[model samples]
Target chain A: MIKLSELHLGILAALGGIVLLFASANFAPLPGQAYGAGTMPRLIGWCAILLGCFMVATSLKHLPEMAKPHLADWVRKPRLAFAALACLAVIVFYILFAETLGFLPTSFLGLLALMLVLRTKWPTAILASLATTLAVYYAFSRLLMVPLPRTEFLSFLG
Target chain B: MLIFEQAAALVFDPYVLGVILASAIFGMLVGAIPGLTATMATALLVPMTFFMDPVPAIAAIVTATAMAIFAGDIPAALLRMPGTPSSAAYVDDAYKMTQSGRGDEALGAALVFSAIGGLFGSIVLMTLAPALAEVALRFSSEEYFWLVLLGLSCAVFVTPSSPTRGLISLLFGLFVATIGMENPSGEPRFSFGNLELMAGIQFIPAMIGLFAISEILRTVTATIPRQKIPRSDGHGIFKTQWKNLKKYPVQTVRGNITGTALGILPGAGADIAAWISYAISKRFSKTPEKFGTGHVEGLVEAGASNNSAVSGAWIPALVFGIPGDSITAIVIGVLYIKGINPGPTIFINDPQTVYAIFMVFILANLIMLPLGWLAIRGARPMLSIPPSTLMPMILIFCIVGAFAIANSTAGIVMMLIFGIIGFFMEENDIPIAPAILGMVLGPMLEQNFITSMIKADGDIFRFFERPIAGGLGVFTILIWTLPLVMLLLRRRKQARLAT
Candidate 1:
């Protein structure tokens, strides 16, 4: 069963091993530092391992019922999953093309793609995305002076 | 204190006052929106801070963050949807009250309790930050190592959800912290030879990707092509609800204390504070059964706790360079960029600035009441707008916000990556807060721990040498241990009953 006790014991055991590994690490014979870098991490690593192991042991002894999960229960929703993926794709496109296309074009295109995937009206999506992109661009470039990538194609708009 | 005088000067400044008012309105608007967050507002505004004086910039950012934190409750109260993760715990409770025609009362309670919580946390920050920073200053690598361990240890017990999940999340975070570059050796320990891994994780973007982007992904799937908005029955949302609030002062106070304490811990933000406060309030409530079924006490506690957390989060920032949460992490970055280094030296070097910032805290909270009211009043009309019209705008903002963080295309890529992670995690019912916490604290934990062991020559006892470290370590153990002990006792009782 997936009770807190079992989880605790598992954590403790894992942490214990980590601690030992760090404790055994050589901090001395390294370059010109008063203390070796591995020293603090190793110490904390040990503490974490000990504490984690203790938790696993404690959980196994009690609250065993908490570990029992209903594996049969599963999400059947498809639209939600698809939408989530679409959002991801748009973001990736924005990141990959933001440099070549510039902030406004890239953001506008990302928003347009997301809007299409979400099934928004074309006019509303296009206008809103463009306006929003322009506003943020102005706010950042003119007001904040955070250097934004500008393309040679868009330079004609100036 | 001589520091208090400069605080007075800063508080009296009209520009500072105006920005606080602007921030409150901004916070309410963002918080009221379903997809937006205070962190986004803060990140977007960080660039603007480069143009202003330090005092005004800090005033604007802090005020907005505090107000926005409170603003999240508005949508949660009005719609069944939560505006932010911090408000998620109370959405059902508050929305249930709204459905039963107690929307005004619920709104009023949230407004008042948020102010109280913010005030309480601010007081704690003002009274304790300088002193704490002085102690934190004494911490060389050895002390910091212990302190970080104490914090991680506390997470084992302090998470508002299942203790096991909390500890698992903490461990996961600790593990991630081990990735990337090594300080002592200047050699990459966890990078596995990747150049990108050498810089470690680009923490802020990773956090944004995990928490913000992931959230978007999860919601995208479940978002009905046409989501239904349940209309309110012509109720007066702005009407004050003093009668209900007066009935639960104790709940509000407890919420404030818990929220403030949680907020003071780095990476533990308002969401955890709200959940923890709500849980504690429920435990002590005489009518515990009414909790998820529209309990006013739950709302008061949740609202107060989250708002208070905003102020409590400032404590770590002011005292040490360490940020209490992600937003504060960005704030620390801003402070450092402005040449105003935090830590013990800050108070000694510029007591007046410290006091001034504290005064901003008080002023921001007070200003929040009116600002919150106006935003709630104004945004109600906007809330009715269909998601189809709004979703595109939000998507644009997300892209811009992502690009704006580091002005790099790679940051946008990072956002998408984390967004996918966040979405999957959410669908699986895994909390994203821990991921953000991990991203923020991972490097700090690694650096401090490594430094400490090097100092003590691998003697773990060096962590316990200081009274503070010892106390913190013990406290961390107590948190994880107590839960296990209680669970054991309950199981024994159950077994006896069964037999």
Candidate 2:
């Protein structure tokens, strides 16, 4: 957990602003006008640059205190850190596998894994995951008409 | 009269009414939970809104947000934990009231006054929005540019943290809005050749990632355990509310007025409303010393203020397409999705739908009384649900919702990326509201600026030639310069003091 202080965040923002300006430079101006696609992005870049500079200046007196990064209590604990990662991992898992595995199986797996990681009992995890996956699939796909991805492997269930 | 009848028919239909009822219950459930904000509740409801008629969908959000805002008081009173950020203003007073066995009074005051405040705001919305829209019908690109800039200025200045950080967040959002080909030039600037990126970031998934996912991350990293709710005193929820109302009539009216005014201001919302109203209540109270010691006086005023502000926020959103707060920002997105563009033109185009919406606000507030009563009785059980168990379910909902946005994996990827950005932004004390507002208004700002530039042939002074545009421009500039001027004046004052 590399906690960012005001100074670090400011520097990062300033650098990001510069990068945006350069990238936006490639966008040619619109025809018959002075402004173009680059206009807003460029405006934002300058604003960011000014904001970053202001942040740095205001915090200069407390620069030492503002620059040090401190870990949150959960970040210091491996279990909690993993819990946070598992939350992200589930999303990543769905992104990678949902289209291939289908919405039901992929979602069920993600839910079950997360419940267990969050320390739910196996039975609770299994039952809750099963119920929720079916309910969500129905409510979204059937009721709301949102098309959840169909599984190539598990075609019958969906 | 005929239009009112048409709107009444629209609102009273089985489908829209059912949606409202279901969303109200959903709102109560979400609001009674600590760490789940009203804005998150709105975000979560968006996917469902994607399927329905525009009236029902807007009805759903309207009902849910009003219920959620009021329901937040349940946890605040019972557990000393604010269910939503807006409820936080008077949490100490609410908790103390419960401890002193005046729990019924505290909850009652919160529910009743919230209803009163919400109704007042709705009436104001009903009356003021159309008139404002009529005035806005005359606004050209120059006027819109100034208005958008003013809105952004409000967002930066009204945050709970450093203005510089808020400005950074606002800039980040502005940058994000410039991602696709909808700018002045049709050429995509930052799409990186990704097809989905060319369409630009969908506000729904990005919003879910920011409010929902970042909150989940924060909860996981939280060191504090859930607080135990106090046992019920077995008193009727609304029994003492009448007495309190009689005693605090001035406070109630003042709070309602203050909240509605603030709500009408772009970028300021219910949370700020509650805080300001609570402070005002204390200042005006005869027994100001009793405020934090199990007091119901402050709770009454602030609770009313929050709910009213929720209604107040819709005024600008409906009239000008500028969001009054985070919730209304999401509402504007929904409005656009429904093909009911918000502006003065909306009044001319969809008068019936506008009336239906106004009716929904009144209905949502009216029902808050009964629904809020039930929630109070059920608060203990709801709050007892462990965060560890609850969080996983919410995360699943977030993932599905992200995927459901465009029915593509690309939306999920955007969610993940924005989730990280949101988490990082929160960690750095950059206010998220500005970013959300920036995203909502970014294109509007750019579109107007470009059109005005073309209209004026690159003459900057033309932007200020029109009376309304000049006034708005001056106001925005003044707001932007206020801090810097204050800083300079402070330095000079300090030098004088040292001498």
Candidate 3:
């Protein structure tokens, strides 16, 4: 919902770059070498910082406008924003519950909830999600042989 | 000729042929869906490629990517949504063509020209690859570093967006590549003590999140009314293309050449090729003012350009173990997974696979004709799928695709995080392609830089001592500084005019 102007993004980038430089300050270099694990990262940090500064400098003439905060249109519409958040929520939910709930139940719940949030009818959402979850499970685990986590308790679905 | 027979034998197997057919369908379906990209399709194919043999696996990716790049034109022509960024270059022209009741012709030209362009690039790839590999074999670390840098430069500067944003995206990608413990020091740089972080970010999940999930999020938030596809006037698709081909033979050849050249450049891909070719097409057009008004001229050129560029990108990937585009970046990963490490020695060590890959390119482009025709015929149904239902379906696939990568939840978590980042970056106008390229090329850049630095004993000027390295170094430096020079000159000229 938040729309950060280039100026703000630039500032954030600069701060991030600085923080990266500090965080990797103690990364041990390869033996008898000055550059190592931190070398490329350090170079990236510097580049980011420079780019951030460039962004800030170029926008300096429009500082007032750059400082003005704005909200994306989706932010004004809670329903749309919630639908977007629902996407992230589904992923987080599956991650937290997949092992305990098993892949099927967790995936089904996630898919159905997302579909319903997006305003699909409950019947269609449930049916489609059920079919999708089953199809995906079979395609990946059976056909592709990815070892998706199985529920310890939900043996039938497992 | 014996080599051709061997390659033909390898690819003609039922298993490999089946892979090609299945992947072609997958490519078309994925490409027809608005907001999904060919690169995303390749990323999704990685896990499936894991179960197959080397030839079939590589064949699947090759066929899928070539088909997908061409298929992206379908939605661009019909719905004005541009299924992939490559199609975005001339989406307006395509949609206008549809609006003016030339939808069938626009699509027809796109399919035919795309096939021809892809074929042209494939031929170039076939003929040029072995010789190029010989040259690449002579490349030292200094040459490679400059080449990668040049590629990154092309990625940033070539886009129609702000170069700053492109740089930001690219830097983010390079930073992502630096996350693990496999750097020059073998010390974990940014793991933060997380075990998964030590292994580094999985490329496929991150790519899926960046492209697919972010696209879903964008679709959900978008307000544009989905265009109602104009009913086909039944003018027949390919009927008009013959005249178009004869009319624009020069543009066709130019587009193919530009696309293939750019494609061969690491980090430059079909999107840039299409854009550049479309620009060139307009520049050379007798009726340049007719552009952006449903003119098939731009579409014909750009359509051909994008597919050819798709083939062109394989040159560096096959010869130098460097990716020519995001799709080929994933292909390189698959190639490594299949134990077909892409490099100069690949021609010497695995001639059949190399030739088979070339043969696959030709076959993929040829197969695109019938499959593409079917996709155009079926575009209406594909376009009818509402975003509300479709987004959720794609999201599930993204989840499963990510999860399938390592059979770990880490991949999913990475996807979610990247999805958010990608959505954020898109909203801010930072291009995602450069970031993807950066991620793909970052390790190569660092590896080459460090190796060169160590070899040269930290003498900076030593980087330009070698002939080819010197030439490449000068070219890269010029590319970086040329804009600045031109900018200053333009300002001075404006001052003089004002006075």
Candidate 3 ranges beyond 4 A from true positions: A149-158, B1-23, B26-65, B68-114, B125-129, B223-361
Highest TM-score among the candidates is held by which one?
A: 3
- DockQ each candidate and list the results: 0.32, 0.59, 0.63
Arranged by lDDT, best first: 3, 2, 1
TM-score of each: 0.72, 0.74, 0.80
The digit string of per-residue lDDT tens for model 3 on B250-305 reads 99999999888778776658976887678678767999778778899989998999
Model 2, runs deviating above 4 Å: A63-73, A150-158, B1-118, B121-131, B223-361, B372-382, B459-461
lDDT tens digits, residues A18-121, model 2? Answer: 99899988788878667888888888888778767876887788978997878766777888899889999989998888888888898899989988988888
The C-alpha RMSD of each candidate to the native structure, in angstroms, is 6.4, 6.4, 5.1
Q: What's the TM-score of chain B for every model shown?
A: 0.73, 0.66, 0.73
lDDT by residue (B44-87, candidate 1, tens digit) is 67877888777888988888888878787887787554666677
Candidate 3 has which clashing residue pairs, if any?
none
**B1-499, model 2: which lDDT tens digit per residue?**
9899999999999988899999999888767655456886788799889999899999999999998888878877775556676786677788788767777788888999999999999998998765643454566899879877776776676555677787888888888888887777789868889889889888767866776688778767666664454555766778787888899899899889878876876655887678667866775689977866888888888888888899888888988888878899999999999999997788889999999999999999998888888888776554455666667776776776676656787877887888888887877677676787687678888999988988999999999999999998997798778778999999999999999
Question: Taking the true A–B contacts (Cα pairs closer than 8 Å), what share appears in each candidate?
Answer: 0.53, 0.77, 0.78
Residue-wise C-alpha lDDT for candidate 3, range A28-105, written one tens digit per residue: 777898777888888888988998998888888899999987888877888888989999999999899988878888
